[model samples]
Target chain A: MDAPTDQAPALVLGLDVGGTSTRALVATADGVRVGAGRAAGGNPTGLGPARAAAAQADAVGQALSGLDPAAVRYVVLGLAGGAALPSGEDMPAGEAFARVWERAGLSCPVEYQGDALIAFVAGTDRPEGSLLLSGTGAVAIAVKDRAMAARSDGHGWLLGDRGSGFWLGRQAVVAAMAELDGEGPPTVLTGLVIESLSLGGAVPGTESASVFPEGAAPVPASPASSASASPAGPIAAPIAARDLVTAVMSQPPPNLARLAPLLATACAAGDRVAEGIADRAAAYLAATLSAVRGPAAATPIVLAGSILTNPTPVAARVRTALAERWPDAVVTPALDGAAAAVWLALDRFGRPPSPAVRERLFSVSTAS
Target chain B: MDAPTDQAPALVLGLDVGGTSTRALVATADGVRVGAGRAAGGNPTGLGPARAAAAQADAVGQALSGLDPAAVRYVVLGLAGGAALPSGEDMPAGEAFARVWERAGLSCPVEYQGDALIAFVAGTDRPEGSLLLSGTGAVAIAVKDRAMAARSDGHGWLLGDRGSGFWLGRQAVVAAMAELDGEGPPTVLTGLVIESLSLGGAVPGTESASVFPEGAAPVPASPASSASASPAGPIAAPIAARDLVTAVMSQPPPNLARLAPLLATACAAGDRVAEGIADRAAAYLAATLSAVRGPAAATPIVLAGSILTNPTPVAARVRTALAERWPDAVVTPALDGAAAAVWLALDRFGRPPSPAVRERLFSVSTAS
Candidate 1:
């Protein structure tokens, strides 16, 4: 992006604001990069508008600092919440971003879209398609004429999000606990969950073995919880059910996402319990996609979010499920949301880039 | 009770400590109540040991205030946690209650029992039977010779307690939210859930109705969300999903229990959706009971917890299900936990009260 700004060509600014972080890209209509910057999460829905605004401004200002603000012809904003991004009063894409631009010395018409659209464009320059995402949460979107036509299953963790990272992680904990309590089938997941949480051998059983209320006898100790281990790291003692519960409950509910990766690891090693969880996650995601995409969907479908972006078991299973439903559908993996946002800006300005250009933009992508 | 201490006879003390409150009863060998007292909750598993001990001490001191310490020859402590009451060091029933008795100037051998046993005794004098309890939480206990022989599903709100107040209330919210999102069937639960949470047309959608991430078009405004009514109370425009989520997430998760009553009211008024929820709750409870009881469980079946003690549809349904499973089994509602503890105290001392005495003790019961 060091080509002299004195002769800088007309460029557009694209911002991908999400719960985890904010990224911005400034590039010319011809697909040559001009500037880039990033900051912490600026998702107005997840974080408040004020903080989200500050993060957006910080990233956008940095992206434009290396070039003339006047040359930044247009701006496009894509929020992670996709069509569900809160707006009327909360959309940083509108009021908050308006203030963000005014403070950063830029004046240009802006185009706003949900993260799903950006993710969709990142995979292809399609004007109509669908997007399926599963990160801390999960959602499916039906894009028509370059905008969301319909959506499904983004109701969030408590009531919905049946196939999300949070959902998978929660299942892992439930399975492990059930096993430890002698009420479920035994699996290596019991060991993995405890080890991942650093919850096994070292911690004293928080609940007393002689607790009277559990009755005259505690649950017949399962094989997995025979005795407490020494303070040796990794050589976990049979994890106590109480310890597992206290660990899971000590944090914000959504942090369970951190444990989702463990399921893939466990399932890969042929653990039936973990495999069952992975199967359910895949089915749940496919079901959500089915709700918005009618039986004979032939449009392009984009997959984004941490779980789907990586070459994980969950992702492979989901792809297989999707293929079964609509084998001919174009299934694309989303790449470079910031770059996709720029392409969208170009499209809004009636200068949509070619397929090669889309690939080039993705080439400048940073790893998630 | 103010019976004369100068002519005191052999008496026993019983304490029922729960998450909500602690109660104590002191009675003579012949079924005459000599003293009674109550204090805030002293369940060690729910509240920390120190606080639970203090509450238990407060209740016991009051119960024994007018009685001679020498006459208080035996003591019994039953905790609401039932068999799951953490013991080794945490059971307030053990070290904590021992300390409580010492502070109250009474020296007597004590018997510790789970609340299920107390509830079972509250219903009948049977030492071997079964108990099903559902309050803020739920559990099924199999009692043998006045001690917990086996237990099922006291895993608490996060993983178990499927038929509890918290579980039922959480279902109401989930159903209402699903309806509001237009993803599920319609029901009065939608209105009741909103009104009960005070979440409705009053909220400014909290989310910008124009939020871009939910895509370009918002959910085609359902018939329910057409207009925003003015500040006039109760004439709600329509409840917004965002407002409902915000309200539910803003409190301790268990507070959802507050919404359980609305389901009963809705079902009474012939709301199929509410009735469906009630049916599932009953089925879940019966399933839990089935897991612990044999096919022809002939022992007395004691029903405890606020839901079963009342005449709600859920309670009625559960009783019918139990009746179907075991035609001749005795099903009784738990009477008084403190009195039951007192009876158990006498029984532990080989002085089990007669049926007439048990009835007199139940007569002195207080409302929840």
Candidate 2:
């Protein structure tokens, strides 16, 4: 007799939407990936949620095009701008996603959640585990009984997104400008931006008040010298630090994440400005984790997202800060987050995901 | 009976060089105005001390053309970038002023010092007093025995410069964006900036990325959906916030003085962002005063400048911060800092300026 063989598990599409990029994966019922796709994520706040949902649905359909619609049992979307529940519309994000799926003509169950929930599930599928995320935006979420029962801090990128990529980017720009004005020491990035942007000595083609609103009839450019001399330039003259921060957060993949470690290193090297920013970022993350863990004595906390990939420096700093509040807690990294989302979706129906399904989800991606 | 027998004192020209504007006043021996003039203040770091000095010379020549150059017995300049003692050929800011006067072909004894010193002398021409400045830049100075010394906490708007116009502007922008992103509460200033700049969208201009360093330049009139947004627009995106602050600071002189109270009221009304900024600004001023008054604890500190002009909330907060450090020290305000520059100059030479000289300095419309 032929050896007993496991049937192909049902496939589920898991999509993670960030400020800079949108990522999607098709995994078996247990979390083994069978297909994948990628696309640019639109700003739901700027672009209505229906449009965002449609775009996301399109991305999912594109990723799962070759597969039969019936084989794809469910779809889960974790998006960035799902926080603002539309007024007079309960389950607005879900409705938006449902509409998108309907438009795509995909006969599959669709679920929508705040991007933080997926990051939390991705990092800690286990009940009673916490996750801290510091991507373009920052948030800490706690899972209990396989549900998002608790959450701490995701107040956009302004008042707090502390150690987030957006924070790092803002710090870098401020430092660069300071150096330009002879108020601060030169940084490696300062020369990089100046050289990268060709931002010195009254360059031609400087845009003026045209940077104001989306539209209001462009104001005639003042004198040429007036434009070139102020090379902190365009955005520098338009948005307030507050709006610039929001704009930075609006990015799909957050450029600041790439620069955050550099800021941490500079802080370590005695750049007071960088150091202050780093210290604040770490404090913020720790506070967020503590808040998510609640007042419990021994709640387990899980680190998540691109930031926690390296738990040695920044992660370590966050651990130290969290220790101040929650001393008797375990801080662990997530083994498989997106897989957890797939598993959670399956578990929602009655039967738990089987071993074969788990293996498939655990399988490494071929793209990498 | 002869109009209080007012006569012009021995004239001494007082000059102030800043990043954006240059001011000069010719005063009589007794500290009376003789003439006044102003021109664009050259950036020392950008144009170098030589060019900046030449610009000052030109302004002075134009202001004093009709007056007897020989009759102008003394010249004083309180400059921002001219703090360095004269070195070799490079000519630091201090010596550059002397050279500028010589090159201008003016016949008079010229003296130069920091702007902080001039503010102090103007605030407290008495034997002992102090001055605190929180403008686009910030500094604190103390004078005793007709000699002046000072300390500065922030010239770097990026690293520090806390409590300055720049800091306020930066903070305002950050807060406004937070409010717009639904991450922070609504603020009056947010609406003020949006209306003032005529921006339609809550997220600021669409050119945020144009402000970012290494991206495709923003396409003009590409509508909100355009992907080729501006790369240099990020830096100026906060312009609205900065503009709001600039409006507060640059309020038509007489009305501008009233903004301090409004700012303080906003802080008191639970505007945490504004309160935080105001507190930091006060701390910055106090720290500078503490640094300058180091080892000379007994001297009274005469507070001067836009930040401490009146008993406004900001000024009160600054006094409170300083009192925390200097428990028993006095803080006095100065009315006319530029005029005090001329008084201090004559005092430096141990010459009692006659009424005619004082009038020339105070009332004359020509530049010193």
**Which candidate number has the best DockQ?**
1
Q: Lowest summed lDDT over 10 consecutive residues: which window, candidate 1 chain A?
A: A211-220
- Computed on C-alphas against the true complex, the DockQ of each candidate is 0.17, 0.04
Number of clashing pairs per prediction, in order: 19, 90
Candidate 1 similarity to native, TM-score: 0.79
Tens digits of per-residue lDDT for model 2, A222-254: 233222434553433332222222333334323
Off by over 4 Å in 1: A1-12, A28-84, A87-114, A201-243, A345-350, B1-84, B87-117, B202-243, B269-272, B345-350
Q: Per-residue error at B286 for model 1, in Å?
A: 2.3
* Candidate 1 local lDDT, A261-348, one digit each (tens): 8777776667778888889999989988887888887989899988998887799999999999989899989889999889888887
Q: TM-score of the second chain in each model?
A: 0.86, 0.68
Model 2 fnat value:
0.05
Q: What are the lDDT scores of the predictions, listed in order?
A: 0.75, 0.55
Please give, for residues B9-90, the per-residue lDDT of candidate 2 as tens digits.
4566777666556777766555556566677764464467777877787768765656655556767677663222121233
TM-score versus the correct structure, for each prediction: 0.79, 0.52
